[model samples]
Target: MASMPGPTDAFARPLTDLRVSVTDRCNFRCRYCMPREIFGPDHAFLERDELLSFEEITRLVGLFTTLGVHKVRLTGGEPLLRSDLPTLIAGIAGLDRITDLALTTNGTLLPRHAADLAAAGLDRVTVSLDALDDEIHRAISDTRVPVTAVLAGIEAARAAGLPVKVNTVVKRGVNDDEITAMAAWGRREGITVRFIEYMDVGATNGWRLDDVVPAAEVVERLSTLGPLEPIGDGTPGGDVGDVQTGPGQVAERLRWSDGAGEVGVIASVTRPFCRTCSRARLSSVGELFTCLFATSGTDLRGPLRDGATDDEVVTIARDTWTHRTDRYSEERTAETARDDRVEMSYIGG
Candidate 1:
């Protein structure tokens, strides 16, 4: 028999995806996330002892699978910054219940760790690169790391036989002009690209409603290549990363009508996906967050480290998830956007 839904929140949304933040330390202080003004030189990051050990993480992941999570993605302020990260990848890959395992990174480190990461059982990677132009890339990431570095990382991942996708956050008057350019690059490179609407993830990004380039317009601009078609069930070429569709899916995958290539868009701003949202974020220090815009999180680390039994810990997660009433995106307003929510860097994007 096929497996039934695991655990459902207040709205009956099943928990299927777990984004695990391996660490909170990042190399690049992207303006949208860990901006230099805030995460400047004087800022302090998590200590090694404070973060969940690989054993603790793997154990928690195992319990998550029992609660209906089959997809796991390793994330970070920059996951590659974590030392001996392949060890953690290897551990998560060993979990029998995990159907898919992926990671999101800045991609600068992939050139050095791609082969090792793939060899350790990483399934795929999604690199965060905003623009092809050096100036725009520099402005967005607030770093001198050239676009060439990210491109090199993509090549390295490909050579290691790991599927690669590029994620671009489109902020109006920012990188919005690069939508078609990005699609063209992906087509030329035979890679899948996903465009994300600039979201009010954290309070400090200075989010404005007008700054959001709607996903429809992004898709419209890309349609210039050729009319795009939604890549849904039974759609050919939809097998890219085996990306799913329907309820609880974030990215809406689409392919060129002429079949030249494929692309996707995440319209969280103009279109709220809260009704079927199924992702649970485990913070770098072990807080279990039920929503991306959550103001507070349930501290699983405290109880786990306090010697709670596996059953007890599992109960904590289940109860917290079951009682969750998060719909921040659906109810986003000028007011809600100002809520002091958790930073994307702390929980990974």
Candidate 2:
């Protein structure tokens, strides 16, 4: 396949990363994402037929690669919930243009599939674990599954030779108290722990400004555990000393001064990095979303199902990216923050 030059958005941000949601089904209903009240048993998820097949996903990825997407991250309500996911991983890995093939999951199912995923050419995995306390974790996840189960999964991923990163969404009055403990645990395990501010991704999480524990506050609290050296300028578009900063990395990297370990804080709320954002998300059903807070998406599945050629898909992708002007985080006011946006579970975080 001949490579086409990738397109840059209106802000001159090149499209380099693609997040594909494999499924919309998840077992745990986290309040910030799939709140139990909204995603209840009665809630209707996409039918199996509605999801993009492995072949279709691979085909789109091939087109995306031509448009300058070098990294592909598989996500979902729970990507592991999708059946035979390793096969999909292997298919995407076979692509020469895809330099990085990763997945983000809740970590409960990693114990069962981590080895298989690694063998199938998965480069890395990011596990979402909000709290270390069993009760806090249960309250956050709204599932009976305990913290030990998730920890075991993390170990399983490491044992399978897959580098792991733990993501924690710190919300005030929810699990903010566990920030230090979570960071210490990740340090002990020699894994990078990233703290994310509670964001208003969807309308159902009861998102309130007061609920957010700013990244600065998180850093302050983590510093109490040990001296934390700013790993970078801690500003948008700043250089990362020796570490290579990716195209759309929102996390401000930091390291413990004593060399225990490194941690990251994604202050999307307090310090938005929208200017350097270069990611495009595709839902399980193939809707292309340029922004996480977008209310609508371009229906790529329709074109794919209609037997549109690769050139046609590429045109749509390039045009959509070229016109992209989304910067929700930077412009998030109280009024605009409550706009009806796509669910984080449906499009991946």
Task: Give the local distance difference test score of model 2.
Answer: 0.90
* Residue 1 of model 2, lDDT score: 56
Candidate 1 residues lying further than 4 Å off, grouped into runs, are 1-5, 233-246
Each model's lDDT comes to 0.88, 0.90
- The top-ranked prediction according to TM-score is 2
TM-score, candidate number 1: 0.95
Candidate 2 ranges beyond 4 A from true positions: 236-244
Query: Which tens-of-lDDT digit does each residue in 1-349 have in candidate 2?
Result: 5778789998999998899999999989999999998999899999999999999999999889999888899999999999999999999999988888889999999999999999999999999999999999999999999999999999999999999999999999989999999998888889999999999997889888999999988988998889887765765433534323544777788888889978998888998889999899999999999999999899999999998988888899899999999999999988987789999999999
* Model 1 agreement with the true structure over 257-302: per-residue lDDT tens digits: 7777789988888878788788999998899999988888988899
Clashing pairs in 2: none
Per-model TM-score versus the true fold: 0.95, 0.97
